[model samples]
Target chain A: MTAPALKLKSTALNSIHRKLGGRMVEFGGWDMPVQYPAGTVEEHVRTRTHAGLFDVSHMGEIDVRGLDAVAFVNGLVSNDASKLVDGQAQYSALTTPEGTVIDDLLVYRFAEDHLLLVVNAGTTDKDWDWISSHRENEDIELRNVSADYCQIAFQGPDALGILQKLTRLPLSEIKYYHFREGEVDGVPAIVSRTGYTGEDGFEVYASPDKAERLWNKSLDAGNFGADDGVLACGLAARNTLRLEAGMCLYGHEIDETTTLLEANLGWITKLNKGYFIGRDRLLKQKEEGIGRKLLGFEVTDRGIARDGQDVLIDGQRVGQVTSGSPAPFLKKNIGMAYVPVEFANEGRAIEIDVRGRRVGAQIVPLPFYKRPKQ
Target chain B: MANVPENLHYSKDHEWVRVEGDTAVIGITDHAQDQLGDVVYVELPRAGDEFVANESFGSVESVKAVSEIFTPVSGKVAEANDSLTDEPEKVNKDPYGDGWMIKIKMSSSGEVDSLLTAAEYEDFTKAENE
Candidate 1:
């Protein structure tokens, strides 16, 4: 996420982020805000305790139309797109022939013939090219509609109540993993009850031009809820939040080398659905048993084990940490790493080389934090 | 505008030093804490450890990133701020006071001459930011 050779792109709410005193940084080749004035930890805690607004317009969206949509998409991804009924969405990934991930995405089934694939921002162009090039006399109309919409995540415990005030749609009726087309603050948008922060919330997609109105009105109505108001969060909080939820961030946890099972995404990879890209590789791996697994750990001693640190055991490099950061809510330095399946058990002693300093840590369960049941 | 007290000298590395006779108290500056966001953890050289001027003495960790805290003067550690081990946010709340990382028993007092004064440090930070 350093300064790229190519010019950086700005989201629809870039100027508004600057106006709100957001600390902007170069993320995924886009000028993105990493944190607002409220700061990362506070913004993170606020989202868990109440609500937070996030502008995720940079995430790419592709519309799959025509009669062969289901079959075409099923062949391209690991998840069973055929299982998805209209108005439902499923977490999925696009993989290569070797069973390694190209990008993790959400498959939103509008109908059997119509669907939307939401992809990571940095891999949008590459994902489109991969999908379009796989066409073989299929009736699929693949279109990358990334620029045609603005996505906002309204997330937290009270996100449902707060966002309900801005729209006439019955927000409660939109179950988790389900979406509905509705008008919010007079702007037509697609509202879903899904989120990355492991909370009860919604991710709304609207026209780019109407983003300012939706962003402003949503923040202005913060007082309509409890005290402290909804904080305008940035990518930093989003990263920590998703990590705490044990969600895999593309390029970090799962890459072009890690398999779906090894990344702890076996639930999403439905091999029985049949004849998908990477299916044979995944099937063979599943039958042979995975050699390694992604597991969570907490630093028992001082120092933080950040990303790219070495995960060691008995002074030998066993694996490497993929995602490591402070879990603000858990109040602990935690991370996830790929280690031998035998060493992935809970409470296994491990060491992480934090800048050549071997720090003591223990393998804990996945999801360093989970929201309480309502 | 970050508060740059006229009483202390500063380093180009965004650390500040408050010298009292041969003993020097050091911590990251207000601007440094602001740029680092929330201070979550700090790793400092233990007492009796020695360091040379401009050398990395310890590290200050925030939620998103970590930064090395450089020594402004050559010295042995009189006392490391053990309080920061439990309450690191003091660095963000009071970078000049309780957030102080270490007190150095200075071996080279003239090393302070190479450090920037309050006015110069302010200009240095402003220029570096620009």
Candidate 2:
């Protein structure tokens, strides 16, 4: 069930979505579209093959400005923020002192004194409170600027070409996980070459009031109405794409109790940097092996395993499904689950309790789908 | 707008029933299939299995969710659409024609009268959508 529409918040493109026949639903207490008339599977496929535009303004953004911006952020997050130069972004998680995920966020370093944090919508308030409460002996100024910007995710293989028409900032110059500030369709925006989908794309961050114009311009430039054109996607399509990409979502793959090592995010956890939040526990866990590890699997039986279902081995519960869905591009029933470290191999046999039946499945590699390397 | 067949009866839960003699063929309504988007799987009850009125006998899975398909009038399952195991998309392509789910030997033929006709079902779905 969802919250009533009256209590939910909407982004700047709400009216446009209604006109486009989007199926509106409540997500993170925001009245957002879950899918459009193109449907979830088709939208997912379109994003993989062509292009898909998404209204990601619901993702929270926070600005941290001060001489100690990078140091302050590094002390709280799991990544080594000091390594970032201008226009670089990294995926990091805010962890408790004991090494638990408060939320997973993207850290963008505009300069040594300026940074922007893009957090999940549902945990925005809580994350704000956590960051604000931790301010001590730091000269950083934190501002919650989520409502000031409309973040548009233009993802797919063809997205770069479509967005390049709007600006002359040498879109090809921006490397992956990097961004450049410029005008898009004559509107000032941050054109970031980053995305959640397994395809190369750009995410434009512009003023909230300018959302409609930019959205329309991108569609017009891409000739959205034609077959094999750009699609206006919603949250459902975004979720499916991220799942197939082997990306983790907050509250599903990592929660307050799930550790970074257990979630297989060792690449982002900079232990050699210095003492930070959750470092000691991470050190301890490193010395003593983790009990469970996150792994990927595909349902061999004719069924789909949803989140919160039990994963079994020999009809005994050993783990739980975290995120499960149809990998539209891959044409398989895939999901992520937390299983015992002993059974986390790539070819381990597992069963998922799909409702009342134990559906056959086997542990596989991390990404069920990956874009071809250029 | 959904296509409501005049020769069939529909339950409030959106299952269509086509009664012929003591056996009734069942499938989901077009409205249900449209709301569900692209169907990926359909789990039906095995033959000889029994059910009562309003009992959930099977489920239909879309790309994102799985919805229970309840039976309006219940009886022993006489036949099931086993072909759906390999080709579930047929439920979306031909919901009423080739995608019929199951056939049950009705225990009480009077239950057929309780379902709404095509006209009544159309009105009911219109109200529900609004």
Candidate 3:
């Protein structure tokens, strides 16, 4: 007899996504929308020019609160959590002892004793287990609050204008990487001025029961008919948007086999911030130099270089593509690859084995596309 | 529902062929374009190239994926839709008309009879979607 397939979980906005004609797909064991009726390209361009609403409820949230929260949490991740002030958020990662990444996550410091760690959905259980195993009788309290709350991201240049119509709070007061508690559509929510897309936006966290109301109200405020109106974006657009911004995806860019230094996340490694998990190996790698580096490149020739495609230098495979797609906003095919350090220089000629044919490409600077200043 | 012209012959791979005497124009069906989302690039075979039935002659790349286009019948390429090289979105806009990918000189006209009719192709797509 064959084993039955595992059922995928759904977010609070699952039905809402279906109602909006979202094409559902399995992502990290969760049934999420890959694109809506307007399509991935439209949603991608909409986010760049106007605004886009994203159902990010599938992400996991862990609460770390207690007297020793700051010190304890600092010891668990690579970045210095002690630098975070109340209402501030820091992008950090949880790594193993060998200097490899467990998962890239956001660390929010509500207070010295109260902190929230927003992690990727697929790694929630593993992250919880990793954190628990490292507790070792510490005074910090850990609670998995993922199931209790739902998250939505409203992103774009016009995101602030649309979101400002929903909540009475001064949205501008919340600076980038900062958050504020406010009522969205009359439901209590934690609104943070942060997003994965390279655009000005806010992420709203609310109770699961009130998620639908917030989603609908935010869409209504966006006025769907306007050319620069809001769109219900899905995971497909999110992937391309993040890639064009040169942000790393957990499994694609940094996994158990890849370290922070090789992933070009050395800025967040903080080797000299005292001893932490993976500190020793990271320090050693820093001194001896990394063998490979993640470099962003644009396909100078025809064809898109998909993930797992080999990066070739004179017909010899040096690395593989981590993530790649047509950058809709930039109108160029771009991707990131882990290549040898010598071939990581900008303007270096390279080739990507797209399908069976070799396609010409050139190493470019990170962030294939950058949003214009407001 | 997608537009499936009853006059055209379709392959299981989602390509549609419009026969005109010895020459036949080929392009992807509306359903195929819909599934592909927004098309960004199209790779077409060079004119005068020969392809066997069910052979992958080219590929259509969208923002989400790359789909190979197969020939419905063995033929020699007479003309390729050069317009798609610069404006691939034409495939998404008018898959049946200006977005047509190629015109082929059929090696055997009888080969078209083995392909699926519009009704059969529609049923096939419906069942596959389900």
Candidate 4:
């Protein structure tokens, strides 16, 4: 007989999500909402024009402390963490010795010996194990703080205004990629000026007990009473927003088999930072030249190209689509795929096997959409 | 609760048919559209294409997924809803009327009688959802 399936874990906001009429789905071992009653399109558009609140508590957080914390973290990631000052965050990736990405994460420097690493939900256990094993007699201490905190992202053009209504701190003073410790709705929290939607937004981290109160206060401050007010968004809207921004999803764009260089993330891989995991392999790959490169494309034909669909050049299969969808805001079908370096140029014509039909497409620049400058 | 017209017929796959003499208008049920979230694209069969009963005639693409649309009876496509090519969201706005997907010249009007009635289809979907 087959073993029974394990129950999916729920975040602190799970009950609130259900109360708000969110449709629950299993995502990366977590029972998360894919969309609320307003649906994905409304939530996505509202996030672009107004604001959207996201419960990102499923994402993992790790605390690193000790005299050698900075050095230890720098030795594991691809980006230069040494450049970050107190209260600043840097986007980086954990790579295996073979130069392939283990996971992309955010590193926050709270002080000289204290740092916080925010990682993807699915890779939390693996990331913890990997980072713990690499300590190897170092005096650093690593603690998985995922369950201790809940993360909420308030994103979009109007995010700052909505967030400022609840806190006394001058939110405008918090520069992009910087964070501050403040009380939100009478609860101590970490307010970071960062988001994945390529919009002006802020991510708030608070203790689990205080998370529900913060969520409720933020929603009330947003005041969804007006049609243009803040909307409660879900994972579906999050996926589309990040895709339009040309941000990479862990499983879709980067994985253990995909290297940083091939994924067009070479700028973050600092070879001269003096020896890190995957440094030698990445150096060799850089010298030898990358075989394939990730390219973004817009569907010129009728149908939408989905993930795992075949990409063809003159009817000959060359590559496969990693992620694709109808960009609700742009009013076009867009997707990303890995193709040979020769075919990575923009404006190049190609065909995607959308189902059985060969649909026409054109190579386009990364970031299918960008927000207008304020 | 989804709208289910008492006079029309429905399929287990969520399609509904309004029979008018020998020609039948087909569209997805209201529950189908709601489940699909936002309809982005609808791939319809060309006029004059033939399909047997229960055959997949086209697909409807939504923001989160793609759902195959099947025919309830053997028929030839008389007309495809051209407006959906540019305005697929009409399915969500008016699934029973303006959102009709195709007009099929039925091989036999009697075939629809064998499909689910409004009451039966409602019961079917109720069980499916549960």
Candidate 1 has an interface RMSD (Å) of: 3.9
lDDT of 3 by residue, A182-229 (tens): 798788999999999999999999999998998999899998585777
Task: Name the runs in model 4 displaced over 4 angstroms.
Answer: A1-4, B108-110
Candidate 3 versus the native: TM-score?
0.97
- For model 3, the superposed segments whose C-alpha errors exceed 4 Å read A1-4
Extract clashing residue pairs from model 4: none
lDDT of 4 by residue, A126-234 (tens): 9999999898877788999999999999999889998998888789999999999998877888999999887899999999888788889889989857688899999
Distance (Å) between predicted and true CA of A64, model 3? 1.5
Clashes of 4: 0
Docking class of 3: acceptable
* lDDT tens digits by residue: candidate 1, A278-303: 99999999999999999999999988
C-alpha DockQ for predicted model 3? 0.46
State the DockQ of every prediction: 0.52, 0.51, 0.46, 0.47
lDDT of each candidate versus the true structure? 0.92, 0.92, 0.93, 0.93
In model 2, which residue pairs have backbone atoms overlapping below 3 Å? Answer: none
The digit string of per-residue lDDT tens for model 1 on B1-130 reads 8999999999989999998889999999999999999999999889999999889988988889989999989989999999998899999999999999999999978999888999999999888876
**What TM-score does chain B get in every candidate?**
0.98, 0.98, 0.98, 0.97
